[model samples]
Target: MRHAVTLLCLLVLAACARVPGPFEHDPSRDYYARPRTDKAEVAISPPRNMPPQMGQRVAATLAMELQSYGIVATVAPADAPIQVDGVMSTRDADLSIEVQVDWRVVGRPRTDEPATVKTRARPEDYAEQSERLISRMAQQAAPRVATLVGKPPNFIPRAPGQVAAGITIPYEFPSDPAADGTAAAAAAAAATGTTPTTAPVPTKPAEQQIKVLVAPVTGAPSDGNRQLYSGMRRALGSSKIVIVDGAGEDVFTVVGAVNLTPIDDRTGKLVVKWVLKDPAGKIVGDIEQSNPVPLAAARGSWAGFGDIVASAASEGVLELLEKAINRPR
Candidate 1:
C-alpha cells in the first residue's frame, strides 16, 4: 500500500507543473460561505493593583484589542452584558508585569479560571516602553476574552466519508492506460472467437496522498509576514493533512496576504486572505478574516498577534483543501 501510494504521488507531480493565478470568485460554489454570528458588546472595568493612569491605559488597550475581533468593546463604565476585570502585578527585578483578567457575563455561571497575560521590558527602556508592554499584554488576552463573550467563528463541517480510520488521502487518480489496454485486448479476442489472456487484478485500489505547500504571508506589518507563515505551518501540522516545505512535492499551495485600511486616526480595518491553489495554478478558494483594530495595537511588532490570526484562519484553509481532494474527477 505504501509503495502504491508513493508511485501515485510521483505520477501526479509529473503530470502538472502550472503555477497558480490571481483569485477568481465562483459564485456557484458556496464552500466558503458560513452563517455569521451576532456580534457581542463588552465593557472593561478598571484594573486593580495598579496606578490609576496605568490601569486606565491597560483597560483602554484591552478594549482596542477586543474591538479588532469585531466585538463592540469600551473602557468606559457601561451597562453591557459582559464585564471584564483585570488584576495586575509587576516584578521590578525582572521588569515583568502580569495581568489576570476575569470575564463574566451577567446572570451566567462564572468559572474560577481567569485569563492571564504577561510581558517583560528591558530595564533601560522600561519607562519609555510602558505603553508597548501594555499593548502586548492586551493582545495576548484579547483572544481569550473574545472567545468567552463574542460569538464564535464559523466552523467548517467535514464532508461525507472524510472520517476514515487513518490518514487517508481523498485524491482521485487519472485513468490507467494498462487497464484500458487489457479491456481492449479482451474485446479483440472475443470478436476473433479465441480465448482471452488472463489479466492480473489488484485486491485494492491504489491511494494517493496529497501534500500542501504554505508560502510566506505577504503585506503584514513588522515581522508579521514571517510570524503568520510560521503560525499557519504549525496549524496545518497539527491536522491530518501533510505539509511540504518545498513546492516541488506539493499537490496544492497556500498563500496569505494582509491588508490594513485605516478607518479613522485611531483605528484601522485589518483583512487577512488565505488563497489555495492546485498544482496547475487554478484558484481553489480563499478564506478571508477582517476586523477593526486600533492603529497602535498593529503599528509595532505583531509578535503574538500573527499566531492568533493564523490559528483562526487555518480551519477554513483545511476545508478548502478537503474540497479540492474530494472534488469529482
Candidate 2:
C-alpha cells in the first residue's frame, strides 16, 4: 500500500510536468466508489469556482479516505472542528499542469497554507491527467486534515526553547470527573440543602525559558544594521527568551530579514521577517512582524532602526511561541 501510494505521488508529479493548456473537467464520474467505515464526522466544503463534478469528486474522495481512518466525513456537515476546501487553477509553467490546495481549521483563519501538486502529460491527455493529479493530491491531504482535527483537547505542544537547554513545563493534571463522580454525587446528595463543593482549577505556569540564538539581521544596509543583533537579543530576552551565542542541543535559532523604507523625513515603515528554527534546523514557524517607525528616532543610526524592528520581532516571536506551546499536538 505504501509503495502504491508513493508510486501514485511520483506518477502524479511526472504527469503534471507534461500536460499543457486548459484541462477538461468531467462532472459525471464517481470517485468514492469503495466501501467506507463509520466514524466521527468531518465536513468537506465544496471548493469554490472549481468544476462542479470535479470539485464534488475531490470532496467525495477526501471524505472516503477520511472515513477509512475512522473519521466520518460529509459535504458540509453541520458541526465540525475543521472543514476542507480547495481551489484549482492551471497556469502555463514549463508546459505542465499545477494544482494548489489550501486547507484550514474552522474558525482559525491563520492556519492557511498551500499544498501544490503537478503532472506531466501530453496536451491531448490533459483532462484525464489533471483529474488524476487532483484526486491524488486530495488523497495525500486527507491524513493531515484528519490528524489536525483529531488533536486532543488538552494537548500542549513542547515549549519553543533552546536546543541546548530544552524546556521544562510544570503542570498538574486537572481532577478527572469520572474518577470523582461517585464521591461528588454523594456529597451533592448530602449537601442538597446547601451549596455543593467544586474542585479548584489548576493554574498554568509562566513561559519556559531557554537558550535562543538571534542571528544577525539582514535585508538592510550594513551601516544601519550594526546594532540589530544586540537589539534582538535584548528584545527577545525581556520576553522570557534567553539569547545564546552559539548553537547547542536545545537552542532555538532566530533569523530575521528587514525592509525599511523612508516614508518621509520624520516617518519610516519597517517590515521585519523572522523565522524560528530548532537546533536540528526544522522551522518552527515564521515570527515576522512589521511596524511604522518615527524617522526622527530611527534615522541617526542603524541602532535606531534595530530598536524598533527588533522590538517588533520580539513581540511577534513571543506570540507565535505562546501559540505553539498551547497548540494541540
Best by lDDT: 1
In order, how many clashes per candidate?
Answer: 2, 21
Q: What is candidate 1's lDDT per residue for 95-186, written digit by digit as tens?
A: 33323344444445556555554444444334553433454445556566666675432222121111111122232234566787788888
User: Model 1, which residues run further than 4 Å from truth?
Assistant: 1-208
Clashing pairs in 1: 19-281, 20-281
RMSD of 2: 25.0
Q: What are the models' TM-scores?
A: 0.39, 0.32
For model 2, residues 1-329, the per-residue Cα lDDT tens digits are 00000112212322452322111112221125433323336788766666676677667656644542345677774465456565556555444444445555566566454333232333433465343333344445554565556632121111121111111112123455555775676687787866555655444464465667778667754333434654565566545565555688878788877686887764556565778776788777775454455433333334233444466557667766666556686
* Model 2 misplaced regions, further than 4 Å: 1-207, 260-270, 290-300
